[model samples]
Target: MLHVNSRTALLNNAAFSLDVPAKIENGTTYVPARVFAEAFGGTALWSEQERKATITIGLQQVFIHTEPHKHWRMSQERINVLNEKINEATDLSSYSQIRTHFRPYFTDSFINKIIYSNGIKNNAILTKKGRYYLQ
Candidate 1:
């Protein structure tokens, strides 16, 4: 676990010291960009001019703003909600019910990864409207 105003992170009962201290504000814990990014097997590219960080892991990449912004915050909230919905679904039928619901939040590869990784079948039946049904 990581706490605010601390330079240490505890994992598996062992504490690892951080070069930059972690900070918490409004219940949000903020850590160093590069360190946080590397922990997730990603490389973080800090853009001083753009004031943002680009984290790339494998073929996936995400952009994070250095400072908080309202629009991005809303988008993140939506993503959190979509993730919750996806996790709650247990079967292909139920998952397909919300296909369009999370379309804006996930890419084809991401959805494919989630379904395949969960041991779900990939053979989905398609309809004329482009919706999927479990075969």
Candidate 2:
């Protein structure tokens, strides 16, 4: 959790310092993506060319576009297409297959990181409430 205008954050009961403090702008609380990702045992990659930040945790990935005007201008149809592509690519079993399918949507380095990471677990169990628990 982060306190407004503070550079200090609390994660799992431990205090961590942030390079950029959390702030409330236009009634929206914005925290540093890098710090948040690291706190959650994830990785955040920033692309200068794209003005985007990609945060990856386990099998979940989030993309944040920093440019305010561009984000508002993004079309829902484009988002749906990208989501469909991601859903289709994730259904593949082999690393090669996944890499091939995701090449168009993701950078080669990002794909390599995901494929080589030791975070993937095969012992996940489906709980009664329909949530997955890593064993």
Candidate 3:
């Protein structure tokens, strides 16, 4: 369940609550590709097997695979501007910096990385500020 603090903001957003089939391994959730490129406007995804692994996008990234953890599956840098206002009304820099913490994209590449990193390879993901949840 994508838990945005503001239910109003979620209503205004296009892809806040995406539904797709994925795998659960090692206490982490994995999402599908549609949840990435189509859902959150992540960069492009390509496979090494599919002709030298070429995916072109405005952002610079080598490649990404699922890492497996609770975070969504994409890179924030590639996604559109997320109007996360956690600290928008607050006078605290600590709150203002919340946006700085979440990679916060539902991209195929990001999801792929998380799955590969966590479930496949078994690594520990450092926590970010935004809450991690399932949808």
TM-scores for all candidates?
0.37, 0.43, 0.25
In model 2, state the lDDT of residue 51. Answer: 89
lDDT of 2 by residue, 1-135 (tens): 788878888888899888889888899888889987888899999998898999999889999887634323435555555556555544346544667777887777866755675323333332233222223
- For model 3 the TM-score comes to 0.25
Better structure of 1 and 3 per lDDT? 1
Candidate 2 TM-score to native:
0.43
Relative to the unseen true structure, what is the C-alpha lDDT of residue 82 in candidate 3, on a scale of 0 to 100? 33
User: By how many angstroms RMSD does model 1 differ from the true structure?
Assistant: 15.8
Ranking by TM-score: 2, 1, 3
Total residue pair clashes for candidate 3: 23
Q: What is the C-alpha lDDT of each candidate?
A: 0.63, 0.70, 0.39
**lDDT, residue 131, model 3:** 44
* Model 2 ranges with Cα > 4 A deviation: 68-135
Model 1, 1-135: lDDT tens digits are 777777788755778887778887688877776667667777888788898889888888889886644332334445455545555533555554455654666676766665666623343432223222222
